[model samples]
Target: MSNDRVGFSQPQPEPDRQALGERLKEAREYMGLKQEDVAKVLGIPRSALSNIEAGVRKVDAIELARLAKLYQRPVAWFTGEDPEATSEVAKEVAHVARAAATLSQQDRQELARFANFLKSRAKAKATPDGR
Candidate 1:
């Protein structure tokens, strides 16, 4: 009855549960979904979802995959295994750039200037001395 094998003897390591929970919470909030809504889709209790987000419960692979699909993100995002997943702003900028590709060069330049103007205005507002 000895089932111990050389390669299978090592136990798997636990994941960073808190980080995973934070990513799940961020993804859910970014998608404007309520815990009850996601729980309904996952066929789990709302309290279970809350526990997952609070890092009090471990998320199984199937649940992670389901949440990734529900949040329009890859499973690696929830696991913190993908660098691109952490850069949501970069993704948004890439999306905007792709959409702008269809416009004329002049229009693109104008759009860039407008974007710069908005950014500078916001930066100025954030400064204490209003530089």
Candidate 2:
């Protein structure tokens, strides 16, 4: 056999770093958190945070996770895996889910019933005759 390598060796391109930075910046702004405050929480310098937001530096997994927690977002949000990251309703649902996790089974059942009732009310309002 000839001594030749026959395999795809090119590494895949990384995700858009600038877009990631912009999303991080947007999340911070949405939470009304200043960069210095967020940086302090992450135990990094403000300039480091600035560089991260500007896409001049990369954010590692730990830093991203910390930012997610600080911003009340899922880690998937920063990674662009969550399509509903920017949706207010989705955020509310996530918040509710987190709260539900701590509830007793009976409480969860009541919450589900309450949600169904609200859905029925909304559906009734949508009818032409407000049925």
Candidate 3:
């Protein structure tokens, strides 16, 4: 008998290992962490971290959790299941683009400067003694 039962969901596709590795690498870089430091924290060799970043090695669950904690990112982000990857973010991006398009050239330059200031301020906040 064909088991075409209701409520039987199809299996989800496997997460892309290469993409996951790329996200992990990006997070590490964003946190200003070198592979050696991250590997040392994980109690693994630097070469293993390199392999993991190159998508040549699989990260076990425990390691993934540790990496996520160190990187300050959710595991779902590395797995391409980021909660922020939603229509709301797209809408916000679109709104920003539209607003920028309407700005005069000088206003746009001022806006860009303001954005740079905000970025630098955030960086300063992240550093000890406010840079």
Top-down TM-score ranking: 1, 2, 3
lDDT of 3 at 73: 66
Estimate the lDDT of model 1: 0.82
Q: On residues 24-68, what C-alpha lDDT tens digit does candidate 3 reach at each position? A: 897787666799999999999998898788776789999999999
Per-residue accuracy of model 1 over 1-131 as CA lDDT, tens digit each: 45587755533324588778888998787666799999999999999898788777788889998999988788887787789866888579657866786788899999989999999999999999997
| Model 2 misplacement above 4 A | 1-15, 88-131
Overall lDDT per candidate, in order of appearance: 0.82, 0.82, 0.79
| Clash-forming residue pairs, model 2 | none
Total clashes, candidate 1?
0
Preferred candidate (lDDT higher): 1 or 3:
1
Candidate 1 all-Cα RMSD? 14.1
Position 129, candidate 1: lDDT:
98
lDDT of 2: 0.82
Candidate 3 Cα errors over 4 Å, as ranges: 1-15, 83-131
lDDT of 3: 0.79
Question: Which 10-residue window in model 3 sums to the lowest lDDT?
Answer: 6-15
What lDDT score goes with residue 73 in model 2? Answer: 84
- How far in Å is the alpha carbon of 47 misplaced in model 3? 0.7
